[model samples]
Target: MQTQTKTQFDFIIIGAGSAGATLAARLSENPEFSVCLIEAGVKDTSPFIHIPFGLAFLARLTHLGWSHNTAPQQELNNRRLFWPRGKVLGGSSSLNAMCYIRGVAQDYQRWSDAGAKGWDWQSVLPYFIKSEKQQHGASEYHGDAGYLCVDDLRHTNPLSQSFVNAAEHVDLAQVKDFNGAEHHGLGFYQVTQINGQRCSSAKAYLSNAMARSNLTILTQAHVEKIIVEQGRATGVQLHINKKTLLLKANKEVLLCAGAINSPQLLMLSGLGPKEHLADQSIATIVDLPAVGQNLQDHLDVLVQYRCKSNVSYGLSLAAIPTYVKAAYTYTFKHKGMLSSNIAEAGGFDKTEFAGEECDIQYHFLPAILQDHGRSNALGHGYGLHVCALYPQSRGEIRLLSKDPQGELHIEPRYLSHPDDQKVAIAAVRKAREILAAEDFKPYQAREVLPGAEVQTDAQILAFIRANSQSIYHPVGTCKMGLAEDPTTVVDENLKVKGMSGLRVVDASVMPSLIGGNTNAATIMIAERAADLIKQEHSSA
Candidate 1:
């Protein structure tokens, strides 16, 4: 990779995370285009990022993520929620739980029905298969040789097995593969891992691509704004340390800065709501009213239980020996407890209020998840993370100032919609039932979060309002839809509305949040986008 700063490139992809890294790799493969991938954080050198189990530890480490929080949510008792977005090379893919979910078929169908033409399930499935290198080899739904590696977990806690059994006991059919036919049942999730180590987008897509002469990767380079000249996004202005530099894109400037930062970058470039930009004294290049609207996220509510034995991955004297053994095994062979993605297993189920598809998703953790695993596990415990898939509430990403370095506020009005609130309540009730099933008889324990005393639906709702958090799947800020929609930022091809030589190629362009983890969908978007860009330019 050429690190010497170049003023121009065929394509400038901002934010070297999941989509950006993948897009850079695929775009540069043509050799007809030179791509520069810009990242705000340093490389993904942290051992915690590569090791699967280290995701729990990586959560508390703020340096790896954007430490931005949402504005006080009135619906959640006026509480501010912290959002951890990957600022490093692979972006959130490096920090996520590694669940390789492509969401259900209906998710893509909804996207197409909502004006994102050609994004239906039938159209997008090939892209998902095209990007996946599944450990189980090539099948109708999986690929053998692709950038992203998907594999089964090498280690799973005994308690996680009980959770799966409990799901079966409760009549939620056993799912052999969550991504195989449908995500309607319960089962262990496949992760984006290769031989126990995380196969992040940076590792999968950018590792080899960075060595290409046509690709340039700029680390620790914060993009301040996109430079739009006469309504065309020409390039970007970035800052490295105290030095300010301008890089131009000969063909297109791609904004892959995830959800929070992508909209902020757009607004900073004087392309957001004119009135809001005027408030910050920013000159409006385009009066795009919906630039930062339509923000959506999965508000997660966790049900915790104290384990009577040391089976859970918690800090204890008894676990010392286990950890020691795990350390030894992981040090040399990369197998054992250390290889376990803390969220070892998860499944999907629906409540009575749900439609034909599942309404709630469950991530079963063998250890206690405190504040997104920020807190060290004090005692032996287990938890179930339940989230409503399709939230009806909407939010926005607003800028605090016109300065490129100003704060970007996230206002996720979680549980504001009555339908979402209904789903949340049902999710908690269903979670309790699953926990109390006969399958968990061996590890029978007491509820830690919403205790037995808090059994009523009203009480459960109150507890959820106080304790629920973001599942880290924020998307749809710069919604992708037809230009006729007032809240649309990018159109079917992901090009910015009324703007030329620019596109938003990240999670922000999602019209709605998918049914499961957003990482796989984001990577698939990049793959499909690379083809779109290639086809468009090749014909141009």
Candidate 2:
């Protein structure tokens, strides 16, 4: 048998996702530190990934995504939801909808209230601003000097603008910046783009940082286990080209593999639910009961409609000119419909009775989305993708087998909560009302999904149960809270409980789901975690 050589690093970051990339870039900035970042997927070099409209195309190219599907959801008419995670250098940030949202301030306050110190809105706001290079210039809430470039929607379609106008028609307040003083209202979405191209975390944070000789990035490398010694994570075992490589961590080993993979990796390395690990004949290390529990995700139901004119993404005789113009504009000026995020306009509004921040969000689309891609559309139409902001349902990610090569079992358990169903019904009704407003007269023809006949809460609920799918935001697997809380996996500082030289810094550590797109929030977590690590090191 041949033995593999072992290498070492100051910091070993698993999964080059949003959080890991940020940590790697920041931690490696100091000349004294040497960091190794490993990603399971190839480098993000696809041109489609950079194009705004090309998301629909890139989503179909399964090579770049981990297209995982959940078990049959009993509440959602037994439908399985498709969860696509980016398997590239930037992770999901490379493949996301590009909507830059900071979520409601209260969401972060809840984390501080729940024992996550220094995670309150005030403390985290600086990190949010630090991660953004807002095109709107610097302000109290936004910073001009940052890695992630945020540009307001450069080109919006007629329907998208009309939807915003209809929001005003229905008395929905409009805010200039959702990440500013308030996040409640309808407005144009700010996107993570530069020169009409998507600026994923890899592009934003790593492109320049990787130039440093201290930062080592290994793409197409999958981490198989966190080598632990007496309850301490000391290194990692990686698989590359069917060969195993042992890399030791001298300072710390960070798990930024995301919500699903992070917990799954922990379980694989004998640090999850004791009972499940025993069943798989794997020895338990930490026996964390909530390692994979507290799973949460937003499930959206697409309410589509047909239009009288050629307004949909569907190419027609009359709309060819529009498509041509859009293509030319994007090709020349890097603007136009080609630069539009399909889910261009949407907002957060609280449904009366929910105590927290807005419990529902709306994603408006100007095209008929028969499938995730526009390939299977049924003519010119529009749709509204709506879902509850907070779901009561919980699920788990357990190992399918003791084999490190096997995929983890994932059950999102969406729509299990009765309130979730009620919220969906209300959102659909609100969307209908918006479509019926006078502002929609020029664009609206008829309601296609759940049509006009499918009225009443019962029918809407049924439709929700039948069609609800994930918006691809999943978190809280490795929750962060006090040690007394058995469910908490990490402390407020992101260090794993009862473990040394290890931390889980990513979306997985979120104690509660944020109100909007989580990409920004996850990057912020990484930024703060890096600082925390530095502070601890300096003090040491």
Candidate 3:
């Protein structure tokens, strides 16, 4: 047996996902700090990852995706849902549909009200602006020069535009910016792209910082556990090339491995519930019962329509020529069909069951999507995906076993809450109404899913149980709250409760799920966390 050598850094960040990438870049900017970013996935060098429309291909690339599956949900007829999380450098930001929504201001207000102190919209808005390089330029709500590129879709399908038109025809205002003064209404989504290319956090934040000698990035490194001693996280033990090595952190060990991995890592490190850890025959370092609790995710239901024409993206022998032309167009001009983000046009709307705030979010796809676009359908069609933006249901992530590389017990328990089911039913009805609007008559052929026959509330509920899936937004597993709150894993400063020199800086720390896409919010969390880290060090 050989003793492994230990490498040291001023800061050690596990999981080079959205938050980790941002933290590494920001912390390393000061020459005094040596930051080490470790990722379990490979580099984001895949051509498909950089192309805007390549999301269709990237979703199925298991090499770059975690491809996690949830436990059977009792509400969804005991069917497990597929969750594709980014395993690469930029994390899900590299694989997600590039929609750059910042959610609504009230979402952050809810966080503050729920005990995520100082996380209200006003306090967090600047961080959002600081992370954005909006193509529309700076404004009271946006920034001019930031790392993440946010711009309108370079190309949108005709059917997508019609979806927006139909939404407006139904009295939904046409919003030019979803992240602006208001969040309600229909619009074309701005994406994390620059010149039709995807601008993942890796490209946005890490590209410039990679050249710095103070920052070191290691891919294909899987962290086994956090090395905690004397009630503090001092380093991490990871495996690379079948060799387990130790990496010490002089300042802090930050866990930014997204929702699922972060909680799983904590449990493996003997920092979870005492009973749960003891069941796995592991010594308990801390009895943080909330380490993997409070899991939440948006449950999305798709309403697909068979198009009257071939305008929607579909696969057929006749479409081969069109695809070839698109390839040429993308290679030469970086435009055309290849520049689309598939779910190009969407909106936020209030369902009849919603309160004062809009509750349902729509993601318009210019193609018939079956199983997150994994299956193929025959004809050209489009889909309107509606999700209950704020779900009352909560699930959890637990270890299936003590093995570091073993599968996790992911239970999002979608629609478990009665109100969540009621909202889901209403969202489906709303999507149907938008597609059936007079403005979409020219393009609409027929409702192919949960068809006109499936009109009754009972029928809609049945459809929801049989077909709903995750929109791929999972958060709140490692909730942030006051130190006295037993359900909280981390404090307002993101430091692990009852521990020192350790922090969780990713979506897992979200006290609750925001009412829209979480990528932007996750980045915002990282930006603010970076400042918190710097502030603490400066004061020290």
The digit string of per-residue lDDT tens for model 2 on 1-540 reads 223343888899998989999999988888788899989998999978888888767668888888887877888777777888989999999899899988888889889888888899889999988888999899999999999999988877788878788777768887667788776777778899998889899999999998998888888888888999987899998898778898999899999999989998888888888999999888888878889988888888777878887866665677779888888899899998888778888887777646857788888888876556726554687887877888888887778887765767788887677777777788887778777778778765788788788998898888888777789899999999888889899999888887899899999999888988899999999999999998777534
The alpha-carbon lDDT assigned to residue 233 of candidate 2 equals 92
Clashing pairs in 3: none
Winner by TM-score between candidate 3 and candidate 2: 3
Q: Indicate the TM-score of model 2.
A: 0.96
* Per-residue lDDT of model 3, residues 390-502, tens digit only: 99999999898988889989999888899998899989988888988786777758888988899888999999999999998999999998889998999899999989999
Q: Write the number of the candidate with greater TM-score, choosing between 1 and 2.
A: 1
**Which stretches in model 2 have alpha-carbon errors above 4 Å?**
1-6, 538-540
Local distance difference test, candidate 3: 0.90
CA-lDDT, candidates in order: 0.90, 0.85, 0.90
Ordered list by TM-score, greatest first: 1, 3, 2
Where model 3 places Cα greater than 4 Å from the true spot, the runs are 1-6
**Model 2 pairs in collision:** none
Can you tell me which runs of candidate 1 are displaced by over 4 Å? 1-3
Q: What TM-score fits each model? A: 0.98, 0.96, 0.98
